[model samples]
Target: MKLKQLSVALFTAATLTAGSNSKADTITTPEVITKTTSAFFNCADYEVVGVCFWLYCTITGCTVKTSAKVAHYNPEITTQTYRNAEKPPWVETRVMLDAMQAGHDGSLIGIILETMGSGLDELGGGAGSENKAASHSNMTFTLTDSFGNPVLLASKVIGSSGYVCDPQLTPMYPYYVSNLDTVAWRFSIPEMFYPQSLNPFGSLLGSNSYNWGGYYPRIGHVTNHDLVKESGLIAFRSAHFLSRRGESHVYTTIAQNSREGFWPPGPLTEHSGKWQQLAPKGETSCKTFPLSAGTGPSDGLSGYRSDDGAHVWNLWRRYKCCKDRGDFLYDIEW
Candidate 1:
């Protein structure tokens, strides 16, 4: 009955693998990079935006060099939320945190804020402290080649397309770390004092009353009962803060105006970018927030909350660029 036994084993494996919300705890750096890069290719959102012209010169004469300008979304950030800051579920972030600790031990101000802001740091869900769950988050740049593709995927893209330009920011950098920015992230500081934060029409994600939970005052604390939605809000808040400049955060601006030969993405606007679930479970496709933001056995989003309230999402942003052809940019035929 050896063949029969093999068949039974295969059936069992298929049963386990067939689910929308199947999950894993932590995602390694290689998996994150590979999956995201593969998703980039699968997206099929690349387009020819315009034609760029450059002035090419030779000893004999000068000529106009032309190339196709293309635009597509890039997985520029890996945003995650979890209860603990000392050890996140992201492999790369954990490694970076260790190195940061080794180099600087801990910031004196950070230690002070952590102590003074103990219970107030993250408000938990449910009544009383028994069901309480605290959350912290990080927004970090994804690892990519100079041209914005993952190292392994870069070769394939370059081989196929011939050329691609670099992104505005370098890869593998942390844009926002909740624990490191306590005054603003934990306490909300002047953000709470802002007029829009208090207004009914401004500074909110989804709505406070729609059972989706409110996302204003953009801090690490919330009173929602749903763990998944809470984590989603935390991630969304991180994205919102990183999109624009002049917020109460230490973030590199992602906004750029189109220049001569190169064209970069502008500031991130709500509903423009999309999120792909990376941990707990993974999705082959990505969609805008709230629409694809549900999780669990009842929901269709296909991922469940982690045991420690940890979650990861790949944030994809649109970018347009063209290869530098010659000495100076001549014109863009849009």
Candidate 2:
């Protein structure tokens, strides 16, 4: 898994399952998103990870553009704080994300869902231990227009499989090494066996895909942490590619803090390490509530690192209060 030599807090399943219910702690970056703006950015300094690459738009917070509010959330906010699987870890939150865009003559709309699912995971393939990624943070989407309601529910995690490759792997190709390098990967099954934004059919900014034989929008394992509720033992790592044509965003909410922004899961198309200013919406401070008793504000809404040796991971209470109430307003933000 690209293990950076950074210390992180450990939030094991046994510890979390002991009490289970975690407080709903969230932090809206910019810490003051006043307006809405859309632009591309790359924040590798902050350790923001993407599906394949390792960055996100610093200014716009890695947005997924849409004409309407995707979910009940504002365009500049992301929930799923407290860094663990949801308590009662088997329940799935309905409408975790709900966004629709007019399609096919503006008759139908595209429905995207990012439900927080919980179930026992027997993680056998990559890791030999049981994990929760088999269920949590699963993405399900559907596009409905006057013509029809085509549904694209996620059968697995995100980026596990993409639609860019054909059955014979003729299309989904390798991507470049860097934003400026722009060199494609050697086209051969032996050279390119995995799905990566860099290994696109042509370029990292071009049509990239995954092995659809796995799942439509397959996701890899979340390294060092689960989606929410502080439920995980160790980190996981794997490369993923973007499938359909839509907005994309990511988060490394579990990583350590003192950071300026969230870790992006991938690059901003082909742009990385570039800067772009987005329009500020208004002026607002995203709130952070108190954690357990003596935990204090330090653990309330924090950014933790998988390698950072700190008590912050076990200090804060799982976010049961705000819960992932309104995170789905924009196109897609993980």
Candidate 3:
């Protein structure tokens, strides 16, 4: 029989076994059954067959082995966090973005989900090992409608964070790099229309230190130096992606600070070491304008610009307290 037909038949047989239990009254041995019909019999079904046979011998009822091997099945459903394998509810993504835009001030939502795999080099020694080490997790953002639905964002790959020798940098610098120019991969989502405004700089604006009394220092402060200036948009790098695939592919990072923003620079900044404004007053729209004659190469990051020449970052920052409270920043659907 065809594979599809076989699958259906196996499922039907299993269902029949469950229903047949009420019809049998007594139990019997397997030896009394001499007629072999199907070649599917196995030792595992001895107990089930014995039960049915005994019932037949004692009550003159039918004796047929109904157990069948069937394929295992699982359905995608939404869970509380992206870390969970199950798909989140359809509305979860939208609710998350709304909460973030309204409460977080436009900060990009950083998610550190499961890793793709381990990267332990068997041939590399001390220096080579350090140069080839992996990161800890991968990351993705949620674009929802107030209810969760997977929405795609425009992004590009960038270099990894440069190497540092300080012990304080170990936690954030989970991966090794041979050079400084290797673009650390991150997703750059430009400013899109949201009903509420997000607080992109709240984390840096509110905190005095990187650590909020935890075993590890806050990752946001460790990864980006611009946070101190509080002048640029935020962008997150996923530890999960770095750890699993290195910095060659597209992925995101999670930021530990809850008050930072992750968007790109505005028009007032210097394109070539001189300040220039690109928008009019009270305008908050992102337009596809051509680069100026002397403008430097585009950095391939995403953000928003205001008419007054102010730019914001779009990196996702996480609060330790918010995680324990079941208030996730974003969710994903299959």
Candidate 4:
């Protein structure tokens, strides 16, 4: 089925099973893979942005070839944040991460991990972890990623495979883990002292301060009264950190420059990109954080907050690309 259709089908199925007594503590790999089919693919977002003209050089003469430049958002990274590193909501590697935590504790010399495994989730504030937050703070951010998404794999088998774009990052891998960077993530290092961090208008999450909160310091701890907004701010902070290139953050940049046949997305900024919730109940559609009042699901709704204080979201950014049809890209026409 088409990706858009798959979303409809999944929602229908979820509605039918809404009454089931069984519940999931954390989002599972199988569940993620299943939700990806529909969550990643959105026919409405996919569009022909422009046309690319390429020079096809031959032995005798050269000809210009044209290709359609298509633009759409790809669910590139699975960003997750939770209170505990050992019990990440992503179930596939929960036990393994727990074992690593144990090993770190038992070693005689104390083998502090320079780098953890790729499957590990972002270590949000926990009981004894570095990110532990004050009681008044509703939550802390621990941004992490399980690399590339499986939606690309699913798209290859689907009938609309031609529309799919190659992922810039590897699949099922960890590109960024907040726990590793203590100075920057915890104290916000120099970022907190920067003018932007000090200014309320700088790096604002929504249109105004009333929406969510400022994005400075890029720390995980949030004192917002609403749980849903807090989760959204944490997700936004992580995305902001990853979207740009900086030595402060231990992460790979998701921003890509436009090239000849491939036009990738640039740095993520508020209002420029959208988010799709993937855990504590997956969402079928995408929306901005601190969604406008009276919009879909808001902070007033119940159950959006995860029981374990773990939340996962897929960052969707726009990209444009065209199939290579000639020797060199000559020009682009709108």
Which candidate tops lDDT?
4
Candidate 1 lDDT at 109 equals: 40
Report model 3's TM-score to 2 decimal places. Answer: 0.15
TM-score of each predicted structure versus truth:
0.74, 0.20, 0.15, 0.77
Q: What lDDT tens digits, residue by residue, belong to model 3 across residues 1-334?
A: 6432443343334333432222121111110011111111321121111110111222654443221111110000011111111222112122222332322112221211112121321211111112245743222211111100010000111101111001111111112210111112111221112111143333332133431111011111122212112122111112222223332433222112222111111111111011111111111112112111111224322222222222211111111110111112332211
Predicted structure 3: lDDT? 0.18
Clashing pairs in 1: 23-280
TM-score of 4: 0.77
Which candidate has the highest TM-score of all? Answer: 4
**Candidate 1 wrong stretches, greater than 4 Å:** 1-23, 99-110, 114-163, 207-214, 292-297, 302-304, 327-334
Point out where model 2 deviates above 4 Å.
Answer: 1-24, 27-218, 222-267, 270-334
Rank all candidate structures by their TM-score, best first, as comma-separated numbers.
4, 1, 2, 3
Q: List model 2 lDDT by residue over 205-302, tens digit each.
A: 11233111121112222222212112111101101222112212122122112111112222212221121111111112211111122222364323
lDDT per model vs. reference: 0.58, 0.18, 0.18, 0.62
Global local distance difference test of model 2:
0.18
| Model 2, C-alpha of 205: deviation from truth (Å) | 14
Kindly give the stretch of ten consecutive residues in candidate 2 with the minimal lDDT sum: 143-152
